[model samples]
Target: MSEKYATIYKTIGQNIRRYRKEKGFTQETLAEKASISMSYLTKIEAPNCDKSFSLEVLLDISSALDIDVRNLLENIYSQPTI
Candidate 1:
């Protein structure tokens, strides 16, 4: 994948982890609630992983977290490159 897209995924993953922690949910709990496999969730949260989730998965995660999808994408566009 391109570097730009990789950064975007990493940012999204960070946001997911941050919000999940804030909501006091374990990865297992969030995965279950989102109807996704724990392994898949792990891949999504792994900063170096190239795997990217679908829009459906993102919506499911947002619903599971009780937050809007935009929350998951917070600061993704504005963040500077690492």
Candidate 2:
């Protein structure tokens, strides 16, 4: 993948981690709530990890976190290119 897309994924992952922490939800709990595996959640939250997640996954995460889908992508577009 290109650096720009990588940055976007990283930014979104960071936002997810931040919100998940703020909500006091562990990766396991969030994964169950989002109907995904803990391993997948770990991958998505890993900094510098080059995994690509789908929009459905993002929506599931947002729903599990009780936040808007846009919240998970907060500051993504503004992130500097890698």
Candidate 3:
């Protein structure tokens, strides 16, 4: 993947995790709510450079967290790029 795309994924992953933390949700709990495995949730929290998460999964995560998916993604892109 290009650095830009990889950065986007990782940054989104980080933001999801940060939000999850603030919301007092654990990986296991979030995974259960998202109907995805804990292992997958872990990956979502720190997605690999080459990994791609589906829109379905992203929406599932956003729903699980009770946050606007676009806002969550927008916040990451708002940061200065290296």
Candidate 4:
């Protein structure tokens, strides 16, 4: 993952937070469902962005969210058409 990817993940993190909250899952609970440590989820959710992420971790979260991984990634990286 490169620095350019970090911004996309950061945006994805925001969407994850919004959706996760809407679904009524606490961070800790989501972490458990995603099979990630709470601390790792915290890092992912941090305002400070990073592109370094495990694909496995992403898959877990995507499964837990009941959303397709491609859709999630697309949502993360999509830019509005002018």
Q: Which residue pairs show collisions in model 4?
A: none
lDDT of 3 at 44: 69
Candidate 3 deviant stretches above 4 angstroms: 1-4, 47-50, 78-82
In terms of lDDT, the best-performing candidate is 2
lDDT of 2 by residue, 1-82 (tens): 5665898998898899999999999999999999999998998999976788999999999999999998898897787876
- Return the lDDT, model 3, position 77: 60
TM-score of candidate 1 versus the correct structure, residues matched by position: 0.89
- lDDT for each candidate structure: 0.89, 0.91, 0.81, 0.75
- Can you write out model 4's per-residue Cα lDDT over 36-67, one digit (the tens) per residue? 88887887877774646777888898889887
Runs of candidate 1 with Cα error greater than 4 angstroms are 80-82
Each candidate: how many clashes? 0, 0, 0, 0
**Candidate 4: where are CA atoms >4 Å away?**
79-82
**lDDT (10s digit) by residue, model 3, range 1-82:** 4565677888788878888898899999999999999988787687563556888998999999999998558666665664
Q: Give candidate 1's root-mean-square deviation (CA, Å).
A: 1.8
As a TM-score, model 4 comes out at: 0.77
Can you list the residue pairs that collide in candidate 1? none
Q: How does each model score on TM-score?
A: 0.89, 0.92, 0.80, 0.77
**Candidate 4 worst ten-residue window by lDDT:** 73-82
